[model samples]
Every structure is written in structure tokens, then in C-alpha cells.
Target: MAQRLLLRRFVSVTLRGSSGPVGSRSSARLPRLSSLSWHGTGPPSHHRAGPTAARGFCVSHASGGIFNVQDQADFTDRVINNEKPVLVDFHATWCAPCRVLGPRLEKMVAKQQGKIVMAKVDIDDHTDLALEYKVTVVPTVIAVKDGDIVDRFVGVKSEDDLEVFIKKLI
Candidate 1:
């Protein structure tokens, strides 16, 4: 099946940290964990100006204190198994709303001060995980706790509204 092949390619790209074309317009690749060089404050290396972000695809470092989930394993540990409820942000690089929501989430989560963890998943690089989560659009926000889905929404939301939603999860 086409889906099966895509899944296989996803595995190759994700686990092996290699780029593979899974029959998609964007030949998106997963940047290896050791291949990043962080600067002050901006998008990650894989997300910089290029066909990657232009195609709404990008991968970030999981070590930069941001929840850059690269695979299902990372999702299990950083989200499902987390002591605190995790907010999963399924996003794309070319998506303007996704760009806005990313920074807003960081600021708001910082205010929570450990009460909440925000996980960012680039749908392009992690299509399998995105499909598992049933994300239909960019900027899809899902709240998870105890390894279960709780609440979710799509598009950009005001920081105040977002704070209120996160507070309830706490």
C-alpha cells in the first residue's frame, strides 16, 4: 500500500536521521540530533530559509529546552509519560499561524513554570505521528495527560484563552 511505504520511509528518516522522499511534494528530512548549531533565538537549523520551511516542513532540536519531538518514542516520554499534562502543538513551518503560536506557547508555558510541557511536532518530518494524532490541519493543539488525549483545537488562540485552557489541565 502507498501508506505502508510512506510509513517505512518515515521510519528510515526518523530513526536513521536521514532524508527520504516518501512520495510527497517536499523531500523533507529529519536532521540528526548532532547536526544542529543553536544561535540566539530564532527557528532551528532545519527550519531556516530553504525548501524545507517553504514547503511547510522543518525539524528542531529536542535539546534546546523546546519540546521538539522527532518520533513516537520522544512523544511517549515527553508527553504521555510526563508528570505534567503536555500540550502537543502539531505545526508546519510555512504556516503563519503555527509560527505565531510557537512563540506564544513558549511564553505561556514558561509562566506555568513546570506545570505544563509544550511539545512541538513538525508534521512534515513526522507525518506518521501526525496521522496517529489525527491532525487534519496546521496549528492543531492537543492536550494529553496520563497517556490519553484530553482536549484539542485548531488554529491560533489568544494567550489569555490559552492560559485558561492550560490552567484547567493543571
Candidate 2:
């Protein structure tokens, strides 16, 4: 029964954004058509933050163009008001798919060569951000251009799809 409810919630959230505990804070903007791929039926099993670079809470593999968002202030300054389009990745350190998606996103952003910037936000550490962005799931990638959300995708996406998403943003 719990699994069924979870599936239902996930479907609703994926299809039409829903209000959660945060009440009026969820985004009204819908996910991009290209961003609608579903990789799983429900949330994956959680894992603990490890000391290794690969499994650490802080992603170290990020290059110059990619960075970890520290706070709402930083997000406002770097993302919302930035000249370049920013890809804000709302993820959790414990989420398995987030781990898989982070590096792939970094690789794709690095290829842009500063044409775009990738901001990594650990949802656990920044619950306020998660709520503000209406991120009910891990690995929610939002494309922001000139202080507005232009597109977004939830869950793990393929490299080709990600590339196309980035290209559309640019």
C-alpha cells in the first residue's frame, strides 16, 4: 500500500507538479518535454556519504565551470543574475541516481567550455532551496536563464538527452 501511494505521488509529481509540506512554494513551471524520461518507479535506496572523492558529499570531480552551491544568497548571485545560463542540479548525497547523474552533468558542462555553468545543490543540506525550487525528487535539473526557469528535468537522463537539453539552453 505504501509503495502504491509512493508511485502515485511520483506520477503526479512527474506529470503535474504538486504542492507538498512547503505549501505554496512549489514551482508552477512544468518540466520540459525532453526532460520527462522516467528511470525508476520510486525513490532508490539511500546511501551514506563516504570519505572517498567518488562517494563524498562534496563532488570534487567538478571542473572550473561546475560548482557546489552554498546558500540561497550564492544562488541568487551566481545563478539568478548571471549572464550565462545556469544548470542548477538539485540532488542529495545519499541518492544513488544523483551520484550517477552528477558526473555525467559535470562532463557535459565541461564540454560547454564556460558557455554554461552547473550548480550542484545537495537537497539535504539545502532544504530551503529544495522547497523554493519545488524539488521533491533527487537529481532535479533546472535550466535557468536570466533569472527565470527555462527548462527542467527530474531523474537520471541519458548523455544524448542531456546534451540536447544543454544545447537548447544555449
TM-score of each: 0.64, 0.65
RMSD of each: 9.5, 13.6
Task: Name the TM-score of candidate 2.
Answer: 0.65
**Candidate 1, residue 122: CA error in Å?**
0.1
Q: On residues 1-170, what C-alpha lDDT tens digit does candidate 1 reach at each position?
A: 24544554554445333343232224244333212211123434344322233232245434333568867888888888887788899986657899999898888888776677788887767778888989978999999888889899899999998988888777
Stretches of candidate 2 exceeding 4 Å from the true structure: 1-62
CA lDDT of every candidate? 0.68, 0.71
User: Which residue runs of candidate 1 sit more than 4 Å off their true CA positions?
Assistant: 1-65
